[model samples]
Target: MTQAPPELPLHMRRDHFDPVAELAEVRESEGVRRVTSTFGMPAWLVARHDDVRDVLADATRFSNASQLAFSLPDDPRSAEEKRKALAGQMLATDPPDHTRLRRFLTPEFTVRRMRRLEPRIVEIVDQHLDAMEAAGSPADLVPSFALPIPSLVICELLGVPYADRDEFQHRTARQLDLSIPMPERIALQREGRAYMEKLVAGAKADPGEDMLGMLVREHGADGLSTAEAQDGAAEITDDELAGLASLLLVAGHETTSNMLGLGTLALLRHPDQLALVRDDPDAIVPAVEELMRWLSIVHTGVARTTTQDVEIAGQHIPKGELVLCALPSANRDPSFIDDPDTLDVRRGSMGHIAFGHGVHHCLGAPLARMEMRIAFPALLKRFPDLASALPFDEIPFRAYHFIYGLHSLPVTW
Candidate 1:
């Protein structure tokens, strides 16, 4: 078969985008196209929701445990120097190991527990607004607002000292983030490893009621020894502890920050939905979910690898190959969503892959939902007429790419 095109949709690179036209082209292209990533050891890209679902639901056929899923090396030497330090954590592991690790974290993220956190979330939202008002109008919503709010909240839960939150957020942003420059990301990962070791030691010696403390008690939350390594280890390794913290911090802040910027921009364009939320506080949570689907903040799919040769949608995928899940495609799949391109607050977002699905679904999803439910309403209520200060074309975006995010959203009331 002839090689397919390598060009990804141009709009995919932007922070704020409506890829309806682009996605339609992708849908047609994927049906016949043999897409490939420029990244080493190329694999076919699956852009249709059904193809993605087939890949996701059949983990045995399409294994995520393959190092190629994330494009990392599996060498024991690199692993000892780099790989073993963080490999086999929940996000990186498959099946039984993934299952076991996720078990320890399930309860902390339940919607019920998340509901109880709404009050605390409200205070956090309000505090950011309060600070914004005092600082003056037309504040950039990132550092002053969007980013710091969730950073602090997760730190509080993890028992990371307020003093260390800045560093933790910096390091967490690096390792989980694929958008940054490679050298910087590698350096940040190293910094994260050193920081987490100290934090884990602190939690080990003096456990608190926080999640890390609880991890110490339940998962042993202590340093790993040779005996523990033989058993796949636990309460935490330098990598596991750092990885968990990294996952939570990124999930907690990045999505919310994107939603705050992107969702706010979308809401402004959709007057009816914005009016509905402005009229009723109870509408915030579900509204947040809808916005998540609409924004699809993650923008791309989860990555998986083929464990065996399999025919999906009549297309053969060979063993030991990589697959990008195309999550944004799933959220807008015509089979599942009617008028998928249209933003509708009334639509059900429960099935949206905005937080992904199955075993590797987002653990901090509930907390993220709660944060937005509280944050959006309080933002509109306080400012009442917050408006972007810069032209839509000129608003700032991160120098780094991959993540669809605005670097600075200057808005004035």
Candidate 2:
């Protein structure tokens, strides 16, 4: 039989609720260590909180755009297709390029905007909760509750047909799974782009009130009246529109869905914390923050390529190298917090790099927080005695994937 690939490198390893013990050991002993990526590319893993933050903060030294230059050997896409793939991707660009795209999107994602969508989000959460109750106990929370809320929210926000969610969700999940062959993942990515391109065409024909419509109205080829052009509204190509929409569609749902699924599991495992969130209105906010800090679900953050020779924690790394920040490890570093391993929902508003840091911090942070803030407390209040249907060990974890989360969480109340 053909041998299985080696286990995920230490930076990506997690033991359910915590980073692996060895990861902690490495963080404390050596702030930066070399490791092979899931794709078998060699990289420097930055583990300490400070060093990771510095790597994330200094985009000039660590270039996101440079990292995009490194492509999978198995990828068969033409140079043009690959260029289209990176178009308008905020995470894959640096400085002015990222700033330009982000400026158009920032207005759409502000805290004020999230407030306007709050009622609809609450409606979506309740709709799912009602469905879960009607379906009775032992519901797989992953599909029944955790998955649909954010998926529906993103679908509505992006003006994608909710009817097509199953197809897009399947595409994104398969594409993000590191275990899937790289070529197959690239194909799924292409399918997603094709799907979004069709939607972009529709938005161009007639803009709706959704985000895609907003983009088309403000940045589409025919966009920007002379006055608006002066205000920085520039005409964007169809590929950029499709690329931006595709990025939002994948990210807006995937990260939050996993947070819901994995966070619910974390809460169920700690009943005391669960009760705090369920019983007290104030507790839910802090609880969400703590859970996010504890769960740092994005596995290793986006890889950065070094622009020049750099020294981190007294270790010298030469120019043009890949640097990976261990988000979970950095979040759990003892120096970053007291009793770093323990879960305490009462810790209010600590700075955690779970959503990443600096210029590339997650743009959907407000929307995600709003969803979780609404969904978590609502689920707990709806099912006060919520629980795991199986032993912890029996629950499946998405261990080898780029994002860390539960594959399915069987629950009962």
Candidate 3:
């Protein structure tokens, strides 16, 4: 018999545009509070902005490598299998190992590289807008607009064939949905790994100019030498390559797509902000930042394990305890910004921890920002009269998933 699904932790819970009141209360009254994690493990929820940043910044005191210990109660994978599963997953590893992997991929995500891709991104956004307009109004923006733009962008970037997007997207969506049974989610994860491994093998055979091929050409076994190996040059293994690609593919699209869907709904709710984002080109950059801050989409940064006894916000946490940074709480902490609950596009949300902080900051942040900067204004420009088809309270929010977003956003112009 299978075990029951775990409850969604308080830190992950949200109420429409804001985090639940309880999370705010905790951030106000106690900067650090012990809570039961989704996996039923007792974890410390770091609620203040400063505390969360400090936790994320100090990799020595807080180790991400031990986070894997909080896996499903009935997971049957062997120790080696589990280790391989996390091989190149930067989010699952600490420094030195993570440092090596990130070095290989950092050049591809720089500002100059994103600038080079800007024209193509613009074309892709326009193409989707054309399709949405051609299909007429009353379309669900989730699939028609929000999902496909970033999905195609990441596919081309990673060298994954866009035709296979449906399968992988379904797998990833299910993989992150906490409502799904643990066993089924694990099965989906395995399936996604197998699918990516084949693509990794193809990239190894005849490398293309995309990121996977770049890794295969420069960091694969064929490219490194014994002398270089001694000098600390690392060759990315097949499992590692697959793991990294899978992570990029999922993150590259999911977070941005959700932002598009949810952000559109947010703008629709506040017409004045909507008008600002749509009419003023200068307003979009800061507007995107504000949206990301308000959304705080990912429930919490990856759960961290305490390497030594640590005191945060005057609360003592013993070594080997699981600690989570409540990102929504941190972003919404009144001390972090003025009028934390209100959505004001004019307020530049510069220091928000939306894409996370410290070493584990989202590698694809530049790409995500570029996509939003280009896509949001272009989308508003294309559909000047865009309005949500559903009522405010009727919107279907994907609350149980690791990422907060809309399941579907029906709209008309």
Candidate 4:
């Protein structure tokens, strides 16, 4: 097992809604600096917006499929089995394979497809709001509203039984937590895979209209047409299906839920911006974008490896080196936008790499945007006097997780 590196100040730190002060200093001075990853590997941390964008857009140069292994707990699975398990996750693949998987999944996440989900999404938000209202004030909005709306939506979309949400959600939370022991995290990963396996089996038995079923119908045993096969659609193994479903189930809800929780807290902190979001219907769209950029819930954009020696920000990075882009730092760089630290809902849409940049960008970004656009306004409208139940300083932030967010946002009306 690889030993953990000596503790160092990580660039990914978030002080409530803002990145740690050191991150800003590093961004301004170094731009591109060598840093150690949590997994104990050395990586070049890119902080400038242009440099980060360059690394992300040029996948051929920065390969996402680089085999940098984080220390995992002891498990029975052979190295080959573990590699196979990771194969179906789009984030872990590069180029032709990533392109192929994304091509099959893109239709489900298209703007049109996400738009069709709007009515249902609005209804879901309202239902959660109603429940929150019924529960009265001083509610922990994290579980009450933030987590459930996207969880329910993704569950229905992926054909995961909503009744089993608690189990899967718990597994996801544990898996992403950096504080959790490696063994526990590994166990959670297995548990999640097992749950997904069952869903894959059901999809195989009788394909429903959901995304999982679509995968089965088009690429599984349901059989594809000659044109479908000729177009590069091929039958996916059950393990691959399970891997895909697990990624969708976990990624689909976790990030958005955290955004909902953390974004609300951010708005509460900036009441003036909150007012803009609450009262101005036209501001909602850009508000969501600004919040995504401001909060930068995902601290480290996807990690990549240098495919070849490359120069970034005047620094020479050798081939096969780990590269980690600081999304929060890049988004907050002065070069990216004016007053990058301030959360201005009316700032209009800036080309912020919140959902990331390039081919490996987030697939559920459209759905996430829709959820927030509906959710923030609806929550504010419902509880016109909504404010934090606990003091701002008391709200716990998930600083150690791969995704940055509030652990619980206790609020009152």
Candidate 5:
């Protein structure tokens, strides 16, 4: 007779959501197998690095086209609408459609194009630290620095007004909660999409140099009718456009913010690494990689559905089943990363799953890395004795969410 795996806590139910010891147990466990959850969803948790990479690289059998499977909505009505609405967005499609949707923005987000934001990113980092200094030595860095810096940078790129950020930033946490009722989640998604619709409409009527405006001017409506065009513009429907904008805002803000906060927490916990970077800010470049690897903020990669039946690592996934790539587990794979648990700055993490793998990899990765490369060193250099305001465990870490992070990284120098 065998005992079943323990159930996840309500507060920690987000998939790939982090709980170190538990994750390690599942990650290091043998074979790709079925994990029946209290949520009633039967999922195949791919814990090995090679297996995760295999699943991600082979998309014919597994399609991003089915974003419906990825959605974990607590409400039926909103879930159905959201699941239906996003089918038009890039993340929701496979092949030809995904390629078309992702292609338009790829060139702009390239390494070269992202380089232009470095100066601005650095300036933003300095500004945040300066603001932190002015307020008080011990201040909550999460909102003041971590949140605003990336939020501001992404908003600027999207042509969203700086003034409007406060509202979006305020709503980001609640909107991102997977535990929130499906109706609430659906409403939040609609509000975000609606906001982006207005923004895109404004950009079309009167152009700007931002990504949204460029997208409108450059990519004429691919298949949408005048009615749909009235809805928004170009290759995507209004709902799709809204989904893209909402995704960009949420992705741009949360992931980078968590990396910054959690990365900082990792450093504070490891003094030797802290001293290494404090002496030479240049070390922040590789240091950020190790941080990404060690922090591995996203619990699971994007939810993918099996477009067709597939056998990976000798484990058969029947057609239409849910197969999710685990980011944290992959990053810590022993085959690729030596001493996968230890945080080694010099370790070659170029292939790390921190951003992800294949075409659907994070478009904003370069920007996030740039922000961190600038932000971390600046924070350490500015505050030599930076210390947490509350007891480490007392600080509010994000619970029950895919993006593992702290709610407010309170600190003082």
Candidate 6:
């Protein structure tokens, strides 16, 4: 008779800001431990900061492209169809292919580009702040302020119509919710792709000054020159463009919006730290970094599979085995920082892997940082006495989603 695998601890979002207590225990005793993934697959969960960085940094040894059937056990889509749906997501590719795709898109997200958008970002933040103020005290911060700034900025960047935000936002939320069945999530993915396909078609017909138009103009049928084709520019296809666009549209807004909502709640809870960020102009940048490290809103780093047998923190993980990093655990690991669990706005928190580590590190770090740095202080200064409208315990956190965040943050001045 064979022995059954041990039951794994739940790894979904938490109702509170803290990571599950079990992760802290595992990090201390067994930095790399075998656990069952939410998808029902066996995986090695790396918790310590150093070990997590090692796994993420070594792309050759840990392949991001290794297809783990994270889909529901009853998923109706075939493997090939699923693969096609995930094809152009930068997070799903590795090395040469990843490098190629990133090269084309990176120029658009550089610090210089993000700086150019900063004035407009500040304007958008103020506009939302204006709306929140007009509504009087006791407003739901998520919809009133948190969601709109990033949503509008990304819409302008991608040339996506702001009027269509609700549809895409709904689809993104459902798709990231772990409780949503695989079949339903797949349907959402298809719907998002169809929407992007229509947008890509429009961009190809008459290119605008947005990212989509730039992509179509540089890589589309009418765009690529013979020399450009020789350099692999023509390799991009309409389907691939749609996939890429959809990924950007979803990722650009969802992650930042959640950060804005969750970060606000965090600062409200830590009044001293909130005062530091609100009162000191110099503290704003480092405060954003510390908040990212402290919150680790993206609960899991992208999952990878071992390319060969590997030893991580004394555990022998076999070739092709699934591997995941518990980001919240790593960010809060005592070895990563002094008083790791405390929210300190003054600390630089520069080395934390909140944006992740190595090649797949977040491309939009500059943009996200600018948004947070601008939005937090502005909201704080605008309403100096902002406080939670509901009891902290009563405020619902998004416990079912892969990206941890608040469902809504009710606040009043």
- Rank the candidate models, highest TM-score first: 3, 2, 4, 6, 5, 1
Using all chains and alpha carbons, the TM-scores for the candidates as numbered come to 0.88, 0.96, 0.96, 0.94, 0.89, 0.94
lDDT of each: 0.67, 0.87, 0.89, 0.84, 0.73, 0.84
TM accuracy, model 2: 0.96
How do the residues 137-156 of candidate 2 rate in per-residue lDDT, one tens digit apiece? 97999999888899999989
List ranges where model 6 is wrong by over 4 Å.
Answer: 1-9, 13-15, 68-72, 222-235
Residues 312-350 of candidate 5 have per-residue lDDT tens digits of: 677778888777776777787778777887887755356
Per-residue lDDT, model 2, residue 248, is 92
TM-score of 5: 0.89
Q: Give the range where candidate 6 is weakest over 10 consecutive residues by summed lDDT.
A: 1-10
Residue 162 alpha-carbon offset, candidate 4, angstroms: 0.7
Over all chains combined, what TM-score does candidate 1 have?
A: 0.88
lDDT of 1: 0.67
Better of 3 and 4 by TM-score: 3
lDDT tens readout by residue for model 6, 73-134: 76787877776666567788788767877777888999899999989999999999998898
Q: Which has the higher TM-score value, candidate number 2 or candidate number 6?
A: 2
The 10-residue segment of model 1 with minimum total lDDT is 2-11
Which model is ahead, 1 or 6, in terms of lDDT? Answer: 6
Tens-digit per-residue lDDT, 306-354, candidate 4? 8889999999999888888899999998988989998888884849998
In the range 236-261, model 1's lDDT, one tens digit per residue, is 45456656765565566667777777
